[model samples]
Target chain A: MIEVENIEDQNGLRPDGRRALELRQIRVKMGVFGQADGSAYIEQGNTKILVTVYGPHQPRGSTGRSTSNITKGIVNCQYSMAVFSLSSGERKRKPRGDRKSQERSLQLKHAMEAIIHLEIYPRSQIDIYVEALQVDGSEYCASVNAATLALIDAGIPIKNYAIGCTVTLINNPSLEDEDNALGKGVLDANYVEECTPGVTLSVVALPNNDSTSKDGLIVVAQGAGQRLHLSQFESLKARVLYGCQDIRTILDYAVREYLTEQSLPSLFHVALN
Target chain B: MEEYPPIIVRLAINRIDLNLIKNENVQPRIYTPGEEISSQPDFLRGHGTYVDDENTLRASVAGVLEKVNKLISIRPLKARYQGEIGDVIVGRITEVQQKRWKVDTNSKLDSVLLLSSVNLPGGELRRRSAEDEQTMRRYLQEGDLICAEVQSTFVDGSLSLHTRVLKYGKLSQGIMLKVSPALIKRKKTHFHNLESGASLILGNNGYIWIGANKQDSDRSEGGFTQDLSRIPQINREVCARLRNCILILAQCNIQLTDTSVTYAYEESMKYKINELLEPEIMIDVSLLTHQRLIQQ
Candidate 1:
């Protein structure tokens, strides 16, 4: 097991023979459901995410955690795992009420709230549920990205877009931990590279803003080890910004295709019928 | 920046990865927005849209425009949940466990039907026997459309259902339509079956059972279109009719409710009230269910 660590040496060649910044093939399907306002399923690298959107309807449960602006909508999020959605033999179907899912749900809610224009539909709710059927690495990132697409599919408005990605530093023994987090970074680490013992940073970014909003710069800027220097943190943040930009580009393409396919329902009947 | 080989090239060269290559990557304008996408036929959704300086790229549909520099796309999905706290969804029994029947809501997850929640025959609310108490498979077999309620949601995302209401039991007659689970919008309550003909309830979890109700009237009188005697049998011709009804509703995007039966589902004789009916409606009546709807 230890030998599998650092499968991608300093040569920057991934175990799968890809580059540091390269993403695995993404297969996206839009409007897979006939009943959802907007829904999407995306397979990124080894991770798979299915996002469904509900609402812009009268709110349920207690209100006022959000305000009375009738123009925007309240976005409710549920991040879950299917009972049969285990990826590898080593992985168990994540327990439904687990803390990770709960925490991730709140984190996603906070991050998405910043992007979506919630003031438009007061007393109403827009539910965006993301189910990770297969988790490899960057599962959080996959959920955020998929939810964004589903939100777009649902036609929800956003002030600006939010995208998430993760970076893992392989920890060069010779080089100090301080120096590595700076630029010797791995962009979008996969399961194998991610498992390498080192500092991992999860970031959610708004690509187009040039990051004008203070908190808007990174929706999430959490690092998994004790601490890192501010400058090194800045480097990691910068890398995420680039990932966000790259993701924005991909998302843009996907939305265009979805819109194009949606205008004609005939094609669906022809194919599925 | 760390230098690396072109991963896209490696992917492009790998015949195996080609299977995973998105349709949009293979073609463009054909995959452009407005539902007439000629390429990447299965492109799904991307992100933002791009317009040239001239503002030519327009999103023709009513969805969010996802563009990448100059690329554009859109796909629509439903967003409303109309069911109330205690609304009943008449679903087909799809799976059966020891004590529960799982029904598909036409939503993302299957709704549940607790055996205890159901009112057994002879008015006994208590468990009858291990064999008598519950063979379960005998009481509510699979493929039955039983009416149930949203008692609660399971931690794993499944809906808990109950059959406490007298009216919301197993279904009978009329053909069945099986569409994507999400189309069945949960409503405040759908209580009436307007067709006037005997209808039964069967849950989709395959637990609820249904029989025909067309017997007492048209079948006995021979005034209606379909022969009554043959209606009891679930044979090739009957199967065809059932399949036809399902296919029609699924194809036309029609919503069916208790009071919402139209010509395609049945004939004018079956409906006691005269109303303007739409083109694509049909009735689904099964045995064990038809008579139950009538006496009530």
Candidate 2:
């Protein structure tokens, strides 16, 4: 069995050579698909995901019949993984329609519903599709982040940036004696570390720009693996919130850069002046 | 046998410059969703904004802010076409319902085209009888394209379209291209007859139709007549070239107007029509056209 202490070295670096609170590198590209109303591609370290957003148009299929209330729009989501996405070199039998994928689809739909202003688009529906091309760890977190970018690309009205992050609490026996007031919790756990005897919590939050509060408004949070102590939950939540805030800054910068590059040359005069 | 070409791979880098507008003195203020735009209570909120519990006006989309006197709104870079009254649009028929046909106008909702609003084949002032209602499908099927004007909007924001004018009705023998609706500039006339013997319709919904120019007599058939005859080879070539030129302009973030499209077509004549599909050549032609437009 791999001990929790072995996941981090003596110099306080994790097995991936990252500090406890350091998140993996993230690269984002918006409007990758011309056919989709909005599309985005994101690479969070080794985890790659492509998300597409369609509609706010006429609802069709099962979504069309469920629209009994025309007062607000409906949000539909589908989460699927590629057949060869597993890192263990094992091919999967099916890409989707499994129980796990369906549960993830429902969870993603709820997260998107909290951020989108559905009331404005009455009698319409917005469909978000997330495809995981590669999965290392934190797949659900990366999907939420990529779906947010796709929604922005489609120009859908959202309340704020919905960022997803994972926090893991590693109980170190050696460090327990030295000032254990704040438990040791890592920001992002990879595949190897995810298998450790620790608790990993996936959090989706809507981060605001206000600096007064360090914690963002949590939209969805699901905990897995071993049980977590009550005292360490507060610190783990704070660390994950901070990670979400950092990601929001990066996404906001990318959005601004993309806008500056894509805006028409003639419209600059009217906007800048 | 032809020689196999060498495949080249390189690191990913943004070839296009990040700073497009060279003027360093002025910068546009862009607002993202949930960012507070104004805290003043008196300012009227427009589209792309909502009032929060704190009474502050916040932006609902990521785009540049537009303020007209007391009204402030944010215009996103791209979105579904929002119909306005009297705007010309091109749409494909999706469904045939009772007394109305559903049209996919690239909008948030499918627009409705009423049978009564169309002109019958016989006369202008002819009354619509039970026979006219029964044969509505024969006039327009499910998959036909039509040019029409926005008559009004329903309470749910879906548009009601009308083809009452002689120039509006079933479009035939044309090439349709879909681009982003934001790329189309609003002008007094959306229809243009190019000096190159082709006619173009720059629909506000970003559906461009390129076809041969028709004579005045052909349009007198009450707008329901379809010209099934084959267009000449030369006219087809001109239409194809114009279609490529318009697409290049749209890809380069240039506005689609008759003058800009004409400039692009003239500048693109140095290369073949297929060459314009290449990325580098597309940028080169659009750059020249952009310079000429600025000079005008």
Candidate 3:
């Protein structure tokens, strides 16, 4: 693992020179691959993830779950990382079917299931396959964001965008020396800070249509590393929630731009009338 | 053998605007998922919409809002084909079942081509028997492509297809191009024999078939028997050109009608057939075709 010490220099900036709550630059391209029903590629900081959505179509062949329902559909998700994704002059032997990838896959399904209206496509199954081409930090966050774009491109009906963001507590000696308030939390942690010996919380949030909940609706939240003090949980959750809302706005804008680019004059006329 | 042109790839910058042909005032209102469309109790929710906890009807997919009377729906720009009755489709056999063959028409579910709905090797009125069920694989095995019409729809939403007509049957020696189903305009006829010596079937499900022109006199065997004979080079070129033409129009989001396709092909004659794959040439051809359509 890379060195985790001195995450923030004396200037009160993270090693990447980002402020405490600054998110990495995000670039997204939808319908990147023509073969899939819907596909997207998202790059957040140094992490890049590609996602392809196959179907809300009939489940093919006979299987353990052969009984097609009349009311709801099934969500099948697969998460795989490229062999060269986590390179430190070393290669990964297996890309998928490992314990870590399987767990992430389950987490993604839960996030996706929350927003997708499964009842609309009864007796069908929607397959979401995500590949991490590059993994710096917050792999799961990038995966969820990429998958959401893929679902949007596929035109799958969803209640909301399932946005993911990770927040980590800064334990760097420089930050603690500066002031007590600096230790509260840091938003959108990179790989080194995530691997540090403090609490790192991963959150999957859905920005509510209304402002009733300040933190939006948290679909999934999991903490890694050392145990966190009960007092810090609320602030960390709020920070991550705000990060998710920011991401949702970016994604929404990208989707609208894509729609306008693809629409023809006749389609515009049809919509206008 | 004729020499082929090398493929050239390039980027397009400041190209034609897709909305160039329309009136300036026709800017479609766009909607995103979870965006509220209406909170009124009188408006009924339709496909691509669901009522949230507060009884607000919200869009489920990002696209444009469509309303018919009191029913409001959002039509996404791209999605899996939603099958409708009377739609002409080209599909590949995915499975051979007891008395039906499962066809993949890019729909929500695999469509069914029942034995009773098909014209047997003998004739259209031939009665299907248990022997026919046993020989189903021989008639239409897995991976065999066919053209058919949607006879009806099942309760589960899967399409029930028929090939009783002479024109609809096992397809051979053609190239299949898939595109977004929204681009294919539903018309009185989906089949077209272009003046350029190629036959095309623009499946409503977005699976297009371009084949060598076949004569009506060769309609024996209920259009089942495969014509393994070689397709002339000129006819093959025509099919290839038509395939590229449909793709270019689709890439530009132009409506895929027979007229648009023929116009695109006519405009593309200045460039080599292989050159049509180039990005700039494709835009040029589609743009010219769009101009012609607008002038009409």
Q: Compute the lDDT for candidate 1.
A: 0.54
The list of candidate 3 runs beyond 4 A from truth reads A1-5, A9-11, A61-65, A68-71, A87-89, A172-181, A212-223, B1-4, B7-25, B215-220
DockQ of each: 0.08, 0.60, 0.60
Residues B1-296 of candidate 2 have per-residue lDDT tens digits of 99654554554573443223244555677788888998999999998888887899999888888888989888887899999999999999998888889999999889999988988788889898888888889889998999999999999999999999988998888789999998887789998888998888899998988867652346666687788888889889898899899888888878889999999999999998777776678888888988898898
Q: Across residues B168-254, which tens digit of lDDT does each residue of candidate 1 receive?
A: 565555555444323343445444332433342322321211234532232221111233454544343333443443344433333
Better of 1 and 3 by TM-score: 3
Model 3: pairs clashing at backbone N, Cα or C within 3 Å: none
Q: Which ten-residue region of model 1 chain B has the weakest summed lDDT? A: B17-26
Per-candidate Cα lDDT values, in order, are 0.54, 0.84, 0.83
Estimate the TM-score of every prediction.
Answer: 0.50, 0.93, 0.93
> Model 3: per-residue lDDT, tens digit, A1-273?
557566544466777888878899999999888889889999999889999999988786563157746578888999999999983546778999999899899999988988898877878889999999988888899899899899989999998888889888766555544354347777777877777666777788878646524433543344564677778788877778788888888999999888877775446756867
Inter-residue clash pairs, candidate 2: none
Candidate 3 CAPRI level: medium
Question: lDDT tens string, model 1, A19-130?
Answer: 6566667777777675677788988887899999885554534653445554555678899977656555455556456988888898888888877656444445778888
lDDT of 3 by residue, B151-210 (tens): 999887889999988889998887999988888878999988888977889999999998
